[model samples]
Target: MIVRPALCTIVLTLVTVAVHAKTPVATGTGGAVATISEQASQSALAILDRGGNAIDAAVAAAATLGVTDPFSCGIGGGGFMVVYLAKEKRVITIDHRETAPASFTPSSFTANGKELDFDTTVASGLSVGVPGTVRGWHEALQRYGTMSFAQVLAPAIRVAGDGFTVNDNFTRMVTENTAKFSRFPATAALYLEDGKAIPAGTLLRNPDMAKAYRALATGGVRAFYEGPLAQAIVDAVNRPATKAGSAVMGGAMTLADLANYEARLRPAVRTTYRGYELYGMPLPGSGGVAVGEALNILEGFELGKLPRAQAEHLYLEASRLAFADRNAYLADPEYVEAPVAGLLSKDYAAKRRALIDGRKAPTASVAAGDPYAFQRDASVPLRPLPAKGKLLREGAHTTHLTVADKEGNIVAYTFTIESWGGSGIVVPGYGFLLNNELTDFDFTGPHPNVPEAGKRPRSSMAPTIALRDGKPAFTVGSPGGATIITTVLQTIVNHVDFGMPMDDAIAAPRLSQRNGATTDVEPGFAGTAQAHALARYGHRWSSAPEEIGAANAIVFNPDGTVTAVSERRRHGIGSALVQNKAH
Candidate 1:
């Protein structure tokens, strides 16, 4: 909440604007919004048009997303928000990441000394964490927003009551999770048509969610964390509303957990990338540290001057090196002695960079680098790295949105319910899915990310804001589980180093290397000459998901105008809108 003295007060503001088409790019002067869903983007634009600040639009859009993109994010889940305050000329972060309940322990995911099946765990109440999205929204509004909670939440309440047209992406996700959703009667009733997937173009409405929003708007944050809603959440988690004959693992979440849940205000992780200052969410999100470390490693090379394939090769290697450290050390800073300062150190990056061979990739797993020696604080002890790093299976489903108001206030937010249809158990009357976020923790450890009482699990949701010469240049973020780091890092590289336009940077194919033996690449990238060239460098490749990340960004142009960009192909092609067209 510290505000530095303002250096630049002139910021692009928003005016009444209209979006004619659901396009992937929008350029204007006043304000801009980009998100995976057209409904969410429009909600944000509407807020900005009404003279709301970026924080207001962001919350409005997030609430709308809960209605339109229910499987991805909602009040049932939690997320990270990175915000740039125009008046203060400062970047701040909100960590509303879900926390393990007091009942959780290191062995919570185990049964009879062995780890439980991952998929089985994901579908059970045991996977649900105390949701933080509601409180996070409250914190944002209280601290920064100029609009009231009732005002920002109005659009989402309308969307919930009026309904929205389900698109192909929505249908596909439902179809993929049919079995999981069928286990719970409430979930089945909402998303399925007599135990079958709901078809595309279907108009879906959740009056219960609308009612829930109305309760929040009337009673404020207290209604959610103290009264009937809190009791319902605890009941759902502890007693699980499942059909008879279905065996579901119930959680131990209590009303106290809900009452005590708080969204923390954390410092934004800052790093310099090619002269631009990048600010992103810090722990308990691993994205900021991991992306910053990778970019720092890549900074030693003149990536723009190198062959495209060569530069990509370096990018992949840097990602691998960065992930190794991230997996070994990064976690909830309150619980783990994370070497954050060392991890972001240029010296540490240079040391890790030396491992990259220009001609070829490493033949074996790249081990985690020792960052303790580079730690600025001499009192911190060195932590031992595990002999074998276990790759926790995090869901590759989430949503991201970027918003900017006329006053130059910008917000980049990434939120999730942990998995598509999350835990597959909706609170019988609440009309939202609880997060399967506990599954994000390591099943067994000796690891920093092992489940613990009241600890937030490490997340890959990276919401970033970039500043150039003391003013905002852009804000960017993406949703793709662990690949989130690579998506964000590569997108920044594409725009800043490769000289791609913001739209092109988001549209370009992606590659993700998480210290694995093989790098996962999108089909578009695999079919290119650069892929072939990289193969010559001993880089092994595998097919990535249909898409790597659904990214959204807003770039501030030099002429006081702004450009909003979204994916043109991935996730049904996101929507980008501007408040007013530049003349």
Candidate 2:
């Protein structure tokens, strides 16, 4: 069913039933699902209503998002998923992050030992990686979901077949990325109309995507990873559209690469913050370690009593310290020895915390701290690699979702295609984009994150779930590449310390420090008295009026109900299941 005739102009505003200062405007009594698109959230809730568990609902929502919000995510991309299964009283962390091709090397994009053109590399097929989203979803459904893969993909198939109305943001993105989209014939044929990009409000349908989903549903994951779909991916990625006679424009990905991809369930990076237990992904991706380390540093401060400026300053310092390690030590653990425990230890954070001078502006100079300095083995073989090149900034291009069921099952999922439009290469017969994930690796550096054959590229996709007293407290995550860590961090702090409601905490003004002296904050956040106070402490704000990351969350209320909240700063949606009194 078309939940709303057109989602672009129709903002999803749930009725506010605020009974307490801590109550959110978007609340429900049984379960809740939040995503950047309302249509997807509605699909997830419908799945819950259809007897699906939290994992099932999450799979439904995520699959639907591939149709409704393809700019940020799709079956072509890969990401991380964290599931809390109440029955087992444990967490399941899945790393479906993309990997470098079998032919990858640190100098894959270098010329004469010098780095290739960044923009050229990003737009070419050289940036493609083996996608894991399909296999990941299949594994999630088989292991945790009650519904079959066919049932979970039903909604997305319907949306792609019946068509959904485009929103303003979708229109704008197409306009901004017109050059790239036009470069690839497949991308141009799929996204354009009459030699021009389609405008918002048009009903867009993708029969090709629907066909792929149908094959996936019937043929199972094999149809995607080992069958014809994999062939299409390999063909599109290898045949780049370079100048008629220029060097080849594609990567060396093979069908074998896609067939070999696995969404492994690894241990969740665990830590405690303000009496709550927090969980995140471990390296290969450093989100969990970084979040854990920053929280450990924050546990020592009384954020509720500090002024906004001091609070910002403290957060800035902690983030700088965490990212210093992130830039240096966090990478594919298969290739580097990340000091996970040492980096997240409270004792280590205290040592790094003491380095912050309240009177001066901090620099990345003290970053990549000696986590091993506080470890049992001071001579740990894993040494920090020097992060070089201009610091990488992942653009605000990703999607996140949080789902909770009445059965106590909860999921936090984040996925991406690297940047907007995602390599602009749609498979010939499939209406989906291929990922530019290989660009995430440094082309010619010896950094821990440098590209290596068959190794997964490190990610900032931190999907986190928090528990208080061993029960679900809140689930949160966002879509701002490097800004994701700080965006999610601030939300947890707001709800845990300042007592802000779920919606407020998610929509609050935010700041992000990615190993730098200047922090970029939400517009108007730095103009306040608190921002000036931070200026006094050398917290120079970025002059560019760029928005930081925006997050979506689901908080479990004390009354046993749950509330879903989306980023009001974004064009998204949230909802909770409530009993219909009329019914």
- Scored by lDDT, the top model is 1
Error of 1 at 305 (Å): 0.5
lDDT of 2 at 54: 85
**Model 1, span 273-312: residue lDDT tens:** 8989999999999999999999999999999999998999
**Per-model TM-score on C-alpha atoms:** 0.95, 0.92
CA error at residue 226 for candidate 1, angstroms: 1.3
Clashes of 2: 1
For TM-score, the strongest prediction is: 1
Tens-place lDDT digits, model 2, residues 273-350: 989999887777678888889989988889889876677678888888888888887788878777787888889999
For candidate 2, give the lDDT of residue 199: 65
Worst 10 residues of 2 by lDDT: 1-10
